[model samples]
Target: MTNRRSFLKGLGALPASTMLASETGFAQGIERDHFSDIGVKPFINAAAAYSALGGRNMWPKVVEAMEYARERNVIMEELQDAVGKRLASLIGCEAAMVTGGATSSMTLGTAACITGTNEELIRQVPDLRGMKNEVIIQKSHRYSYDHGVRSAGVQLIEVETAEELERAIGDKTAMLFFFFLNDAKGQIKLREFAALGKKHGIPTLIDGSNSVPPLSRLSEYLDAGFDLAAFSGGKGLRGPYSSGMLLGRKDLIEAARLNNSPHADTVGRAMKVSKEELLGMLAAVEFSLSFDYSVENVRETRIVHLIADKLSVYKNITTKVSYPRTESGRPHLQIFWDKSLTPLTVEQAQKELEDGEPSIRTCYLALSDGELEVGAAMLKDDEVDMLVQRLGQVLAPRAG
Candidate 1:
């Protein structure tokens, strides 16, 4: 889970009035909205799972669970135990801990892997002056999010080859970290990486944050023998945006929790996973696990086909429907346009969609490869029509 720091307006500290603004303050009221009075109306999400597009929507059950947890007040420690145990069971892990978000989990998980449940070490995080604080990561696995590991006070050692990775692991090597999104770039595969970590007696952690939605991936890392893994509760899971889960060996997860909520002075003190978000995450996990993938695929395919057919007449454009897998478990549609026909670049098309009657978000990937790819996983029943209509508007003939 990513640590969501509330925006402090002018003074470093938020005024009490600002914090008490509205239930929807987290979702809207920025100065950029041209749709309606910024605070009074909701903005349409056309950008798909971008954090700026409000990440992902919470499942209705998650919202209800949050409300249920909010209405009652209990000792937070007990709440943590129950929520953690249930979450661990649902994810098929020995234990689990909810943090501010996936990045918080990454930071706390890294700290716990290095420092264990030691109180002295827990308080000295992001500054391991006299501890084993080196983490081995593939050079290809480097990303902006790796800052989470650094935030834990660990130094990242970049390795590209299997031999380099092996040599990089030493007594000071606290963790072997892998970013699931960069699996294609890394030389170490999951099973091989896990084996290497086991051989060296080092902890292995895989950041599977945006890699969810396919469901089986919930257990895939564990099954692959990873010692610890972090996932975004908000992304594919459709839980609260502020919640995320750290799943791993019982000891490590417990240590992670020790450094998290219901406790202060630890590195993760400020990264609290509220009781409401915890409950909502549990409900979201249950709902996601219970969903039928095959049936969902059929529906997703029908939607993809409908969009593909609707735009088939435009000879200048080309559309091929394919099942693309994201961090989320299920496969969704990837719609790409032929860039050769007209000068309507991907960016222009995206902006056009965004500026339309109902703003729509589409995927944008910049690769040396030919055209741009847009995934359809984030679209809803009504948004599907909106997408088709908007595409037609942009691709139609120009007036003389």
Candidate 2:
């Protein structure tokens, strides 16, 4: 097992200039621990990129790109255009642009469908006087993030069946929105949803944030006929926490750009993505494309087994490795125990781990057959050992 020291040493071997040194005095080598100074403690993330956990760590190369971008200034529109073109080509899409986040992408994409480069309409967003005032979505697919779509002044018309969706589409319908994670729960699947949009001449948008690792899905949704798709740069891509990508129809992308930052009187003007985030997102995409998932899968599997093995020695404790039905596309360890064997409930165990020194976070459920789910995707090698030790201590039977 790789220790955290070795892992950190490997990171230190990256170009020293990319390391977080004092920006004011480069030669002084003053390193500041801001999180410590601010009294906010950082925990070992044994869970997936839950935004509350600060999303995911950015890659070294992504950090380097952001640092490089910080020192350079260019016309915002031109940089967005150039990065969009490069990203589009790489992802095999018609067009793409960086946004503040996946939610921002949804808002801008909806704005594009409503306004479509009409300057008169762009300035009148959330007013919808002369624009498409409705977006069709499945009742099951409706989520909190759709609030971003609604921010564009369009009401979400919910339907449960293909027939209802077809009938709901009208002149006021601006776009068809689908939540990729809820694909199974919805009556209409992705391809059929896109087909419905195409048959009615309405743009289709999909929120596929947190869906990567198969990475092919980036282009697969576009190829499947969705006119627009949003992916989070922070989740699987490990870019800036505030960055994301919107990809699809060229005209809509152009319209989205017009409705975004560097433009005044637009809804997306407030949802600005910095040049640093844009370049960092680009670097993340490049790194993700070049990453070896087969090796990553093996490593994650090993980590899961290691944790499971360490905890299995405790009486009545059982560990099982399972792949989630979600788009996370990684193996997770589910630790279960017979409640009679230990006084610890799943909730108590979770709280104990969280409150312990070097706090650890994992998913927990309170159901009868509940288990603590530990995801290895975000864990460091040394942290894995820490997790195993902590979990063992927590699950150990107390002496009578």
Candidate 3:
């Protein structure tokens, strides 16, 4: 649950120097040891934008926008409408709205498909008596997050082939669901899957959370004919962790809004996105669209090489820099070593980094031949040198 409390706790744990350098517009000279006061430890994120890790920190402008929004008082519905319109225009989609996260977007979007703006049906959700109650998804695309869709009280019909999908669709079928990352694993590709939805007149939704940095992906699925797409505001976009964006189809988006907060007894009433979060999300999208990704990519690549080069001194250690073709379009370092030659296991090394001063968190890939994955996307510029030094110390030979 990456809520405001958790986000504030993480912010409280940041070092004063980091806070000062970030220019987040907080009152000057008012520093409180919020994490230390509560015994919560914070670490440098060398991992991806995982919810469990509190996602990534917001960009400076995003934080500023949030602060700006904190002082305003306006009609919630009007704010949603205005922000939704602005986001849709920026993303080149027909419509868009900020939600609690990608999961909330899933739930709201599913509810929209299950029961449109019909007032009676809107209040009677999760109790589908005669409405479209089935959502078709590839078996390979089935994941933990699909719980969001299931929360709408619709049965998920899983299919492996295009024919099975067509057979599965009927009067009860509401929407076609696709997980963008699992495109290769599934029997049907992205375009074909969306095309099938079009052929049958069913709406399609793609979960593309954490699929930015290329930036074009914000509109890619919509352009591919998917009626809707969900994206995380926290991941890659560097907005508030508790916020997300749902984009596409004006009517469905309208229904989603009606089913969301500021409306009583709705399924999304509890999934609240505050004014601060809304403004922050908008700022994140604007900043990300205007950001020069080429510079960031080059810097990330350099950081990966620095870590790999510094750690490659040990004879038994092997370092490989890999650029994954998946959602995370950044360079990563995979460090592999023979455990027999060293006293430290991959788990032990990761734990040491985590427990050390200026704590660090890196991916410990037990399945990748016991290698460690170091990501540069979340590392601050100054933290890079500290990370290199920490790796050198941890990987050095121990005294017998």
Clashes of 2: 0
Tens digits of per-residue lDDT, candidate 2, 1-400, equal 1122321222212232333332224435547988899999888888778777788777777878999999999888888989998888777778999999899999999999999999989999989976789999999998888998999989999999999999998889999999998899998999999988888899999999888866777887887889999999998888999999999999999999999998989989899988899999999988776665666677788998988887777777898887875636588888877766668877899999999988999853521136788888778777977898888888877765
Write the residue-wise lDDT of candidate 1 on 319-377 in tens digits.
76544434243333444554554457667876787777766666544321233344555
Q: How far off is residue 28 in model 1, in Å? A: 20
Candidate 1 vs candidate 3, lDDT winner? 3
lDDT (Cα atoms) of all candidates against the true structure: 0.73, 0.84, 0.84
Model 3: weakest 10-residue lDDT segment is: 1-10
Residue-level lDDT of model 3, residues 30-106, one tens digit each, is 68988989999888988767788898778888988998999989788999999998887677778999999999999
CA lDDT for candidate 3: 0.84
Give the Cα error of residue 144 in candidate 3, in Å. 1.4
Worst 10 residues of 2 by lDDT: 1-10
Residue 387 displacement (Å), model 2: 1.3
Candidates ranked, most accurate by TM-score first: 3, 2, 1
In model 3, pairs of residues that clash are none
lDDT of model 3, residue 110 = 95
User: What is the clash tally of candidate 3?
Assistant: 0
**TM-score for model 2?**
0.89
